[model samples]
Target: MNATDFIVSRNDLQQCKSIETQPPEAAALPADALLVKVTRFAFTANNITYAVMGDALKYWQLFPAPKDFGNIPVWGFGEVIASKHPNVAVGETLFGYFPMATHLVIEAADVTKRGLRDGAAHRQVAAPVYNAYARVSGDPAFTGKQGDYQALLRPLFMLSFLVDDFLAENDFYGARRVMLSSASSKTAYGLAHLLHRRDGIKVIGLTSAPNVAFVKSLGCYDEVVTYDAVTSLPADSPVAYVDMAGNSDLRERLHRHFGGQMKYSGRVGLTHRSTSPEEPELPGAKPSWFFAPDHIRKRAREWGPGGVDMRFGAAWAGFAPKLDQWLTVTEGRGPAAVQQVYLDTLNGRVPPDQGHILAL
Candidate 1:
């Protein structure tokens, strides 16, 4: 059968195309292999971060593409149409990392009641989180609108959960206030929600003027300020900066404005992709990249087996319900709609309150 894939240029994310190719025949499946038919996936600014940091984070390595193009990884659901693996059935559904294509073939390993890992040789070196797939039938989070919310915000919220844990684990780096840039983004606001519940630490959201009302509506941030009004924030108080926008100019401005008062700076996303790659020497804490998988591994060692999952699940139970009131899910199908949504997300045209689920 012909598989359609949407690929983007490695050098220019704006340059993308949908191409048709042949997938492996179901009858000729290798031992312990499963052919998953891609159904739908969520696309957000976070996916754009995967593209922007594809090389640095090895995202491009997950799915092979042409020499100059890449198949961006996304979190979504798929059905096992054909399986040579004895433990996995043909009709089972899965939730995990997938390419922007119609199908995927995974060499299933570590089969269990919960899920299995894609033990394909090429994917061995990628982060373990991206390599794992969960069985939808056994997952409690698969019911109701949970699947859509999971597709849209679970991954981002995981990062938010980790960031909040990381900060609290360090006693907020001796800061009384925590500031988040790109405050309107899902990840940022998710972090804000967690931090807002904490005592003594005020959550401040730095956003664009147009998004001030939306950010304020979340009721998670203590103070919402526009980019131009960043100087209005008191520089005397110790603060931790969690950056989601990755705007170099804004980074420099905040660093200069806060100077020694900037206790910790964690870079998480690149919602603004045109920023400079070189970060000049600044006065405040040096900007550091926050890789969620690294933190997950760290927590696993400190918390023992399934401890992270237990804590995350509890947090998600409380947080997931709030999203229904905050997000409006919009569905898109086929190549044209997918391409348009991709472009809209890439150009920052999608609203912060809307979640996009697309099928190719």
Candidate 2:
């Protein structure tokens, strides 16, 4: 069998190139290894965050990349074509983080009935979220589901689930109104939907004027405000900002407008990748980086395993069904399509309503 891998520029992080070669044989494997046939995966702004922050967060270190080149990480489904481990078997459908390639060789450790964590030497210190992989067949949510939702939207929604839980856990930092930049983004919208379901606080969607209509149509936000309309928001009322776009200029304008009334600001993603300006002094709350894994671990400890599940499960039950109403899932296959769509997402050209699932 043969394999293909895509590596992008590590220094500039601009371009991606593909390489094809013979895949590793399963005849002789490590004592405990699982050879997964990469089936399909999702790519969106979320995946772009991995590449942009690869060096800072060590995304490049997770699945090894060639010198001066890096592989982008994605969440997707794979099948275990061969396993040398006693616990795992061939033909098992699994879900986890994977590089854009034909197959991945995982050294499985901390094996469980549901699945196992990738125990590759390089991954030991990485976040457990990426290290963990699930046996989809054993899970009810994915048992009979197609690759559409799970591949693309589910991962983003998970972050949304965490952000919503995090904000509520902290009582939205004493603000009754929440403003979400890049509100049209899947993660932002997912969070907005969860926020809308709760009482007391108002969920306001902030996006570009062109996207305002689409963001409004999602029916998640209580108010839809365009980026140009930042000053229009009430200065008298306090608000918390959940930032997804990572645009510094907009942050400054927001801080200037809301001033001391801006109770909290949480930075979530960098959908606008190249525009990080120095954080200038501002009157509002300082923008804090919202790392989803930290919150996930925190809640898992605070709520216990099942208790955490119950909270997110109850939220997902209310939000998942409404997804089909707004999202139109599409697939991009082969190396050419993968590369093109990667550029599209990185450039922020992909429309909010079209969800992309890639098979390479």
Per-prediction TM-score to the true structure, in the order listed:
0.98, 0.96
- The residue-level lDDT of candidate 1 at 158 comes to 96
Taking the tens digit of each residue's C-alpha lDDT, what string does model 1 give over 1-360?
899999999999999999998999998989999999998899999999999989988889889999999999999999999999999999899999999999999999999998999999889768899999999975667744689899999999999999999999999889989999999999999999899889898999999998999999999999999999999888998999999999999999999999999999999999998899788999978899988889999999999989999999998888988997899999999999999999999999999999999999
**How many clashing residue pairs, candidate 1?**
0
* Worst 10 contiguous positions by lDDT, candidate 2: 138-147
**lDDT string, candidate 2, 1-360, tens digits:** 879997898887567888985766898778889899888888889998888889899998987778898888889988999899998989998899998888898999989887799888898767888888988766667643345677677778889998888888889889999999999998999899889888998999999988988998998899998889889999998899999998988998999999999999999999887665677898889888998888888888888867866877687777778877888888879999999888888887899998888888
Clashes of each: 0, 0
lDDT of 1: 0.93
For model 2, the local distance difference test gives 0.86
Query: What are the lDDT scores of the predictions, listed in order?
Result: 0.93, 0.86
**lDDT: which candidate is best?**
1
Off by over 4 Å in 2: 138-140, 143-146
C-alpha positional error of residue 308 in candidate 2 after TM-score superposition, expressed in Å: 1.9
lDDT at position 163, candidate 1: 99
